[model samples]
Target: MHDSHSERMSGSETRAASGLALVFAFRMLGMFMVLPVLATYGQDLAGATPALIGLAIGAYGLTQAVLQIPFGIISDRIGRLPVIYIGLLIFAAGAALAANADSIWGVIAGRVLQGAGAISAAVMALLSDLTREQHRTKAMAMIGMSIGVSFAVAMVVGPLLTRAFGLSGLFWATAIMALLGIVIVAAMVPRASHPLQHRESGVARQALLPTLKHPDLLRLDFGILALHAILMASFVALPLALVEKAGLPKEEHWWVYLTALLVGFFGMVPFIIYGEKKRQMKKVLVGAVAVLFLCELFFWQFGNSLRALVFGTILFFTAFNLLEASLPSLISKVAPAGGKGTAMGVYSTSQFLGAALGGILGGWLYQHGGLSTVFVGCAVVCAIWLAIAVTMREPPYVTSLRLPLSAAAVADTGLVTRMLAMPGVADAVVVAEEAAIYIKVDSEKLDRTSLESLIESAPERAEA
Candidate 1:
């Protein structure tokens, strides 16, 4: 409704957000640090094969996808920190296992264990617990920024670490980082004063079916799935292409990653501004998918040349960063009222599953048909995604508003109807159990003052 609604965070909100952001960054850094070097270095492991190596690279996603919902459910039952602490311990154990392993299967097993720690939902829930409703979006934004920064940092530093110590050394470092995350959770993050229902933050089991059935949300889910599948599958070939074909040493791999990421980051900004400010998100999104298709074609044709590889990489990351930032925004804009958390949970699961499928499929393609085939597959996926995206409706420019409702308002059958009839309100859900009403409203058209007055005028009575 107004910019001031989220402008300031309380001292506690700041502290909690910062602490949790660091914890999330550390965990993600562990997962991403191996992406650039894994294809090449993993060959030294016993029982290594291209297919097995691809499995190892993507093994974490399999476990992460499987455990994510369970971890969230456990956290809801047992409390957030306990679940987080257990998850970190599992991650550390996985890291240690990977560090000591001599075979690709061992590494895969370790990666699976690492992913089993699945604390993302718990961490977000904890952040929601620590911040006020008005400030929750800003707090979540902090975590999102932390993830982007972590990806950049991992790409730059991962090669350096691997060169200095070796693959096992990198695993050891990840284990150490996981341990550090445990310490941060225990000492740095603030505890909630009491257990919170966290309807806004945690998934509601009942909302799952409806969220899955929503056609727009289903499209977004498939978009993320295709996006990450391409991402993981591409890397199966990209690192090897850099070394064997492009003639870059493994040690110098970071140069390509760092340069490409920097260029891509800068390139993504203008598109994002145009998409948001110009209200041209669908256009930008489809354009990015087309660019992704072109990038795959470039890789397929010109991957052997150093100069072409770099150029294609820059273009690839540019398209990637844009899509990565835009998809979640689209979800928020399209998700039905009271179903945001459920929609997000499904979206995340799709992303992780895509990563796992990408690894497996990419490995198979590379093993049987070579790198060119992998690129061809990725291009085909992008082509399909682009075709589907083109037919989708433009997402409404709406923000969800949560308002406190009196007991009488909760009992009133017409509350949701009245809210939806109000100017700019696109959807409304009234939850009697929580005594709250959630509405999606077009910010530019919303009459905040009138909405407030309407809520104030709603009849009041004690619960029966």
Candidate 2:
């Protein structure tokens, strides 16, 4: 049977994938690095109304969610570089605007502009352009790590940055960082054509509905949306809980962040390794959600002691890390091949919208009710996600095949059709020069005897 995900990546694939990964890391670092301290520091600024403060915190997500797909389509039409450049330029302006602001409204305006950059979808599309089908998962995983690292760093450094240069100084520093990113893309990064188009596809509306309709992809998207909403809402309630219940000082809040991040990093590794290697992804993902549900339950009951809150925080992040890693990997595996970019675009948008919604709703919830209510709200969210996750089907197993190519192989238009007709073969992608096929298949139903007989009789049709 034919299979997908078999080809070993070429040197160029590694380089381009790594470069795009770094670019996204730099961009996200600037955004996430300010989040941990935004609420505490914004209190004394002019025009610092509570509602406006929430907007400042969430404005970027609103913009990023709204613009991500449009910017992606723009990149498809105009070229990746131009859209990336424009996005960075807008991002820089937002940073500069924040740096010079004396009022909370000014910061809100700056954040809105920063969100306007909306280059995530474009950057992902560009990575797809650079890597072949077989290596795309590895390429996407690199970007995921970049995002994870950025979040981890920001959680730790957000407080330290504010302590040293204040929020305005952080803004200026981030602007400079973004400017450097622009230079890297403009000079150091090599231009790549879309692998499918390898020519101009000038910005056209990416068909969005197909991704929205895929049941498996839809489940993962819901996971992402709920996951981020919980994260944002957690912060809204957590700081006050630390102050009123746990008696922790504001400046010392970073200690909580640092410990949770470290613990979560170490704690999540084993499950992540086990799930991927053992092919127990569905179990691990559901178990993680169950843990999240328990953590929220714990949060509602225990904020009186620093130790308990610290433990609860650690547990929460551990589950968060697992879901964050697993959801997208599964999405990549299940997404339709030709429209993976569009699927990802919708996925990113939903994720950001959740973040924005979390911030806004969390504020209202906190203002109206106390800590218990906020936590109960998060528990409700995880319950919803867990119910959705219960419905997800087991993913198909992928197999790799290698063959030597000839001129005849290049010209065989019917080869793909023949491969698709094979029993147990769910999906197939082939590379001519590489002479390899990556396939998704039903492993339990694979007809190994028939496959061997065919290869024995027709050696040229041999499987790798």
Candidate 2: C-alpha lDDT: 0.75
lDDT of 1 by residue, 95-159 (tens): 99999999999999999999999999899888978987778888988998898889889988889
TM-score of each: 0.97, 0.85
lDDT comparing candidate 1 with the true structure: 0.88
Q: Model 2 misses residue 175 by how many Å?
A: 1.5
lDDT tens string, model 2, 173-244? 778878887887766566674434411111223335667778999998999999988887777777667777
Candidate 2 similarity to native, TM-score: 0.85
lDDT to native, each model: 0.88, 0.75
Local error of candidate 1 at 176, Å?
A: 0.9
Candidate 1 off by > 4 Å? 1-7, 460-464
Q: State the displacement of the C-alpha of residue 81, model 1, in Å, after optimal TM-score superposition.
A: 0.6
